[model samples]
Target: MNKSEMIDAIAARTDLSKVASAKALDAVIETIVESVAQGEAVTLVGFGSFKASERAAREGKNPKTGAKILIPQTIVPKFAAGATFKARVAGKDE
Candidate 1:
């Protein structure tokens, strides 16, 4: 679901107002972003881990022109679902 819908759901579950839920979500997102930017991982026991991965420079072909190109290496954010999260998505509880 989208942010607003998520806020609604959280409000329904937690007795929080939409505004408060929005702030809560925003704070969580900000914290994650900040931690990742600083090269740290964020792990929620039953959810997942958020971390960064490095990509090596590689040669690639241009789809349209079929020309060779050098793709620059970069660091990218990644998420690996934990056991509980995987179970929940698979319709099982861990």
Candidate 2:
């Protein structure tokens, strides 16, 4: 669901007001983003982990012109779902 919908869910599940839920969600998201951007990994049990991964330079073709180009190496964010999350999504009992 979208952010607004998620905020609503959080507000309903907890006794938090919508504004408080939204701020809490924003803080969580900001923390995760900052950690990942700083080359640090963030892990939450029963959820997932976020980290930076290196991508090697490679040759690629431009789709429109079919021209060969060198793709520069970069560090990109990646997520690995925790076993519990995977299991839940797969409809299997943990």
Candidate 3:
């Protein structure tokens, strides 16, 4: 679901107002982003982990012209779901 819908869900579950929920959600997202951008891993038990990963430079072809190009290396955010999150997605009755 989208951010508003997620805020609604959080409000319903926690008795928080929509505004408070939004602030909380935003805070969480900002924290995670800042941490990952600083090359730190953030993990929540039974949920997932987020971190920055390095991507090596590689050669690629332009789709339209098929011209060879060098793709520069970079660091990108990555996520890995924890076992419990994976299990729930897979419909395990745990």
Best by lDDT: 2
lDDT (Cα, tens digit) per residue for candidate 2, span 23-73: 999999999999999999999999999999999999999999999999999
**What lDDT would each prediction earn against the true structure?**
0.94, 0.97, 0.96
Please state every model's RMSD to the true fold in angstroms: 1.1, 0.8, 0.7
How big is the positional error of residue 31 in model 1, measured in Å on the Cα after superposition? 0.6
Model 3: lDDT equals 0.96
Q: Ranking under TM-score, best-scoring first?
A: 3, 2, 1
The TM-score measured for candidate 1 stands at: 0.94
TM-score of 3: 0.97
Q: Name the runs in model 2 displaced over 4 angstroms.
A: none
Model 3: how far residue 92 lies from native, Å: 0.9
Question: Which stretches in model 1 have alpha-carbon errors above 4 Å?
Answer: none
Query: Which pairs in model 1 have colliding backbones?
Result: none
Please list the residue runs of candidate 3 whose C-alpha ends up more than 4 Å from where it truly belongs after superposition.
none
Clashing pairs in 2: none
